[model samples]
Target: MKRNICWIVLLLVLAGCSSPPPIPYEAPTLSFTLNLPDYADESVKNSELQDALVQRGLVLDRFGRIVPLDEGSCLYPIATRTALLKELEQYQSSSFGYTLVSLKKQGDDYFFFPNDSRSQTLESLTLSFDSVLFDLTSIDKGTLVRDWTTHFAYLDQTLLVTGEQHKLLKKKHLSFALRNILIVTGQRASTVGELSMQFVDAIDTTRFLVLTHGDVLRSCQALTQGTMISTPTEPYSRESIKSQVKLVSLLPADADFNQLKQQQSLLSTGRYLTYRGDIATLIDRCSAGQGQSNQALCHSKADDSSARKKKVIVFGGKHGA
Candidate 1:
């Protein structure tokens, strides 16, 4: 994922952000809980369901939510926003994964809308949590068949979403949906148990896949503990930061999106994406200016065209403001 950070920075910058103050943002917690529908079994509750999840390569995190253990049956992807988006973009770029719709969360469920980078016009669908995995298209079929502008989502747009909805996914981070074949039908319990090690990538809070081997049950604990980052702290170098900040936005079209799905390569890739996301955050501050609270303004996508081009620092590994 470190190797791919260069491209991701570009993707985010190119993707853009909207207007907001430079005040510090408490990192959004990606921790989630699986909400069982009325029809699913009720017996998989509390300890009984927890025990079943444990048998199936899962464990309760410190936050008391169920997360995947690093065993051969499940994977837990923990990374920052930049790395996660890059992995999502690169997964498709490397011919390993493809971008599904960005997720729109309403109440307990997530709906799919076309917000992919290529900006294609595609079909919309809803996603639901079955005990073990996510179903890409919903029986509900097409969602809110309305104006296209309302459906298209972007990562940094924060504004009021009006009328008729409970809650919409305001932050435009990527959602990694399941299409990988490692956890297959019929051989599900057996094949999936063995294929967990190869998992790469993740699903955002919406449509997170939770597999319950023994259970009715259903949980994020990984994130950097920091506030308002500007430059590399004592241990790191400016040279490393600049190289990562430069965006090299090209990705191969030949790769299939499936390669990064369902235990494809290594969790190390997910870690790499998180690293990039943190660096992306760092650049937002460093470019805003050293020690100035408004330094985050340097990278805000909502800024005008001239502002977008005025990055305070230069890249290609040189170190000077």
Candidate 2:
């Protein structure tokens, strides 16, 4: 009797339950535009700088998307990476004082001699950090490596001699310190593995170096470049840099036109990437040489837009190194 009563209740409950609504499906459409900063363009020309950028995976299409273009069939990723690195170099140099200390393009990997001795000092500091802090490996291997080092050094006289005042330094300088760690370590990491792997290796290596180096006067050529150029006085704005980087190309990634258009709606929105200078000079130069529409002025349109289009202007932040 109890079993029968339970079955009747279950049937009533089952009959009362309603079916769920179907999920709506929309096509996955990609839509975004990206550009290279001025320095990234220049760095692409330098084989060494290009390698550094490739290692970091910063070289992407106009949409800020990375697509490995290793084969000869596709060179857009290669070109985009090279160009973006060149453009980024300006900001790196101006903001952080990175100079072309030395650049040499090896076979697939480029060997860079940044001329900054922070690596040496970091090597030493890593040793010191190892000495003072116990069980630091937990944080050392983790993302906190950079943060801990900056905090530890600022609190302790790790970077300065015993007599020097550590309290005077603000924590803000830690970011710069962290940047130095990345550059030095990232350069070293670029040597052992593929481009992307190398970038990570460099970062990992920097953690060890930052921990080991105690207080040493490292080479400041990179830093000096910033000072000489008065980069700090002008200061590089991250937002402005991001904006300028967004303007390099309409379709900056590694994809066919259809693929790129599918990824970026602006490409289909009737936008083109053109250099203002190129457009301004195209008419005069074309009239003097070739008057055909299919000739000089034709290529002058930025990417695909006409010269008269209202443009988003970007200012060069600084000129360091």
Best by TM-score: 2
Question: Tens-digit lDDT track for model 1 on 1-321?
Answer: 985998999778766675443555343333334433222233434434333333223343332333333321212322111113333334232211122223444543454332343321222221121111122222221342232135323212111121122112212222312233112122222222122211222222332222222211110111111111112211123233222111100001111111222112222222112211221111222332355543443333223322312334322342222
**lDDT tens readout by residue for model 2, 57-137:** 233333233222121212110111111233333333221111112222233221222333222233333443321211122
lDDT minimum window of 10 residues, candidate 1: 247-256
Reference-based TM-score, model 1: 0.16
